[model samples]
Target: MTWLITGGAGYIGAHVARAMTGAGERVVALDDLSTGVPERLPDEIPLITGSTMDADLVKQVFAEHGVTGVVHLAARKQVAESVAQPTRYYRENVGGLATLLEGACEAGIERFVFSSSAAVYGNPDVDLITEDTPCAPVNPYGETKLAGEWLVRAAGQAHGMATVCLRYFNVAGAAAPLLSDTGVFNIVPMVFDRLTRNEAPRIFGDDYPTPDGTCVRDYIHVADLAEAHLAAARRLTRGGAAGDLTVNIGRGEGVSVRELITVIGEVTGDGRAPVVEERRSGDAPRAVASAARAAEVLGWRARRGVREMVESAWQGWQLHHGK
Candidate 1:
């Protein structure tokens, strides 16, 4: 079955596309190239340039490619930007999702995998967040993701589509240097950017109520996250009853920010101490995933560790930045 991967040229999307294709799944990519690099995708996979907001394009791709399933990853994602432009986030993330769902339902596509975020849980006080954790997004970006999940589930129930929402934790590392994330919005790349500039990596806050007095997060290698998507897609394709499944894609391990910086230092050989700063608004003290649901549902677990993530991400940073 041919699957349509929206934002297939992006960092995460490209990884997902590659993982799916490597598993011998027929796939096509749709990306707007806003922040996505076309070269990240392989030469063989067909890459369509358009917006999910375009209903005609969505319908055309679905019909022409005979797409039986969809891995929807195309959306605006940036906490600061989303906060600055809430309307744009709603329009692009939520509105685009609505349009795609409409087209998928019309086209009779039964399988869908949505790219969700751990941000939907906001700063929950839980030590290990589960799928059942209450969602209280602190920013518009998270709000959009949560709303997107709702739309996907509602559409699935109404249209008899088997759907999975994979709520991602901190995604780092790469399958390869070329497939590495080019954006610095994430912590790994952000730290890499600072180190390359000979600047001390800035820690947002160091007085959180954690063991190290810093925020703790669960980091998963991008490749593992991609593989999780494949597992979800395959489960849907196996012809189970139409239903909704939401699971966290994480390592089920917590790494404090300070600990991560130390790992980066060890990997990059730059031991410049990080500068502690005021806590960023809405910063969660700790947000680790239980990962039990994913293991039970998808039979998947992260294979790589934090050191591997930093090492792989550092390689990508050097490849792109020539550091």
Candidate 2:
């Protein structure tokens, strides 16, 4: 089946596009090159350059590509930035998606895979969050993502579409580029970018309720997260499930900030260490996912572990920084 990937030139989208093409599937990458690089896309995969907010452009994409399924990874994903500019987040994240959905429905696309986030759970009280957990997003970014999820649900209900919203938790690493040109504000690669030479990676909320008094997160490899999208597409294609599906795509383990820094030191061969600072408000102490639902539904599990996450990220950082 042919697939249309929004933001296909970005990190996770690029990885998914490559994965699709490597499996001998027909694919079209629709990206505006905002944070995305054209060089990231494979030549064989046709790249459609335009904004998702343009209804005519998105419709044109569907007409030219014969798209059967969509992997929608395009959105304003920065939590801090969203907090600063809520209007931009609403317009870009929610508005652009509305246009995309209208175009998708008109073009008769039935399957969709949304890039949701564990931030929707907004610091769940439970040790491990599940699909049934209430969405109480703390930041504007998370609110927009949750709104996007609801929009997907509405589309599914009105039409006969089957959708899977993969909620990611502290996504990092690279089968490709972990350090994709995420805006300067992101957590992982931004830290690595600053520290490629001797700069220290900054840690917010050093005294969290975790093993080492630093925040703990479930960091999944970008490739594995991309694979989860693929598996969901197949499951939906088989007419297996109905209604809006939300699943956490995490490794189901907590990697502390200090632990990650140690791994980074090993990866970069720079034992410079991370600079700890006072807590950032709205920061979750520990966010681990009960990814059991993903395993059951998508038959997907994160095969690459913590070490791979650190090393592959270093690989991308080294290449980006000419180290």
Candidate 3:
């Protein structure tokens, strides 16, 4: 079955596309190229450069590619940007999903896999988060993801489509240097940026209730995260589950900001200390995941550790920056 991968030129999307294609799956990449690098995709893969908001274009791609399944990863994902520009986030993320669903349903696509985020949980007070956690998103980005999940499920049920929503935590690392995450918004890249500049990395807060007084997060390698997408796609293809399957993709361990910085120093041999800054508003102290459901449902588990994340990401960073 040919699958339409929205945002397939992006970092995570590129990895997913590479894995899917390597597995002998028929893949078509649909990216707007706003932040996506076309070179990240293979030479043979056909990439349709456009926006998912354009319903006509989306439908046309579906028909032209003979797409029977879809993996929707196109959306504005920056938390800060979404916080500042809620309207744009809502329009692009939520509106884009609605338009794509319309196209998928119209094309009678049998399978759909949505790229969701752990941001939907906001600041869960639990030690280990599960799929059943109450979704009270604190920011516009999270709100859009949660809302998008609803849209995917509803559309799938209405149209009799198999669907899966993969909720990702802090994603880091790369399968290859060329495929490393290029954005500085994430903490891993942020730390790498500071080290490369010979400047001290700044921690957002140090007065939280955690043992280290810093935010604790679950980090999953981008390679592992991409593999999870492939697994979810296979499940959809097999039609093992009748309804929607929502699962968290993570390493199930909490790494404090302090600890993460220390690991980065070790990985890069830049033992410079980090500067503690004031806590950013809406920062969650801890948001570790319980990956049991993902393992049970998709038979997928993250294989890389934080150190691997740092080293692999460092290789890409050095390559990209000539460092």
Candidate 4:
């Protein structure tokens, strides 16, 4: 079956596209190239250079490529920027998704995999976040994702389609240096940037209610996350589940900021101390995934550890920086 992977040239999308194609699944990629790198995609995969907001273009791609399934990963994901411009986030993430869903339903696509986020459970009070955890997004970005999930599920139910929403935790590492995440939105790359400049990495809040007084998070390798998508897509094709499947893609392990900084120092051979600063607002003290539902539903679990993530990420950093 031919699958259309939106934002397939970006870091996570590129990995998903490669994994799907490697599994012998027919694939076509659609990316706007806003922050995506075309070079990251395999040479043989056909790429459509456009946005999902363009209903005409999306429909054209679906019809032209004979797309039977869709993996939607295209969205404005920056939390801070989403807060600053909520309307744009709604328009791009939510509105664009509605348009795409309309096109997908019209084109007779029955399977869908949406890219959700852990941000939907903003600052959860629970020890570990599960698929059943209450969703209370603190930022506009997360709100848009939750709203998109509703739209996807409603559309699927109405159209008799199978859908899966994968809520991602902290994504890191890379399948290859070229596929490494180029954005510095997460701690891994933020610390990598500071180390590259021989500067002390800034640790955002050290007074959190966690070990070593720093925030803790669940970090998952990008490759493992991509494989999770494959599992979800495969399940959709089987048609056994009664409703849309929602699952978390994580390792079910928590790593503190201080601990991660030390790991980075060890991995990069740069043991520069980090500079602690006041806590950023909306920062969760601890956010870890249960990952039980994912295994039960998709038979998928993360295989790579934090050390491997750091090692692979450091290699990508060196390659990208020419260090």
* Each model's Cα RMSD: 0.8, 1.7, 0.9, 0.8
Over the stretch 1-323, how does candidate 2's per-residue lDDT look in tens digits? Answer: 88999999988889888877876778899998888888888779899888889999899889887888899999988888898999999999899989999989988889988888887889887788888988899999999999999999899779888888989987777786643544445565666776755588878877776779998888888888878877887788777654578889999998888888888777777768688888888878888999899999889998889888777876777677655
What TM-score would each prediction reach against the true structure? 0.99, 0.95, 0.98, 0.99
Model 2: residue 151 alpha-carbon error in angstroms: 0.5
**Candidates' C-alpha lDDT:** 0.94, 0.84, 0.94, 0.93
The lDDT leader among the candidates is: 1
Q: Give the CA lDDT, 0 to 100, for residue 235 in model 2.
A: 82
Per-residue lDDT over 192-243 for candidate 3, one digit per residue giving the tens place of the 0 to 100 score? 8888888999999999999999999999999999899999999888885547
Q: After superposition, how far is residue 66 of candidate 4 from its true place, in Å?
A: 0.6
Can you write out model 4's per-residue Cα lDDT over 1-323, one digit (the tens) per residue?
A: 99999999999999999999999999999999998999999888999999999999999999999999999999989999999999999999999899999999999999999999999998889899999999999999999999999999999999998999999999999999999988888899999999878799998888888879999999999999999999999999888863798999899999999999999999988898899998899999999999999999999989999999999988888888754
Among all windows of 10 consecutive residues in model 1, the one with the lowest summed lDDT is: 234-243
Off by over 4 Å in 4: none
Model 4 lDDT at residue 200: 95
Query: Candidate 4: worst 10 consecutive residues by lDDT?
Result: 314-323
What would the TM-score be for candidate 2 when compared with the true structure? 0.95
Model 1, 58-116: lDDT tens digits are 99999999999999999999999999999999999999999999999999999999999
Compute the lDDT for candidate 4: 0.93
Worst 10 residues of 3 by lDDT: 234-243
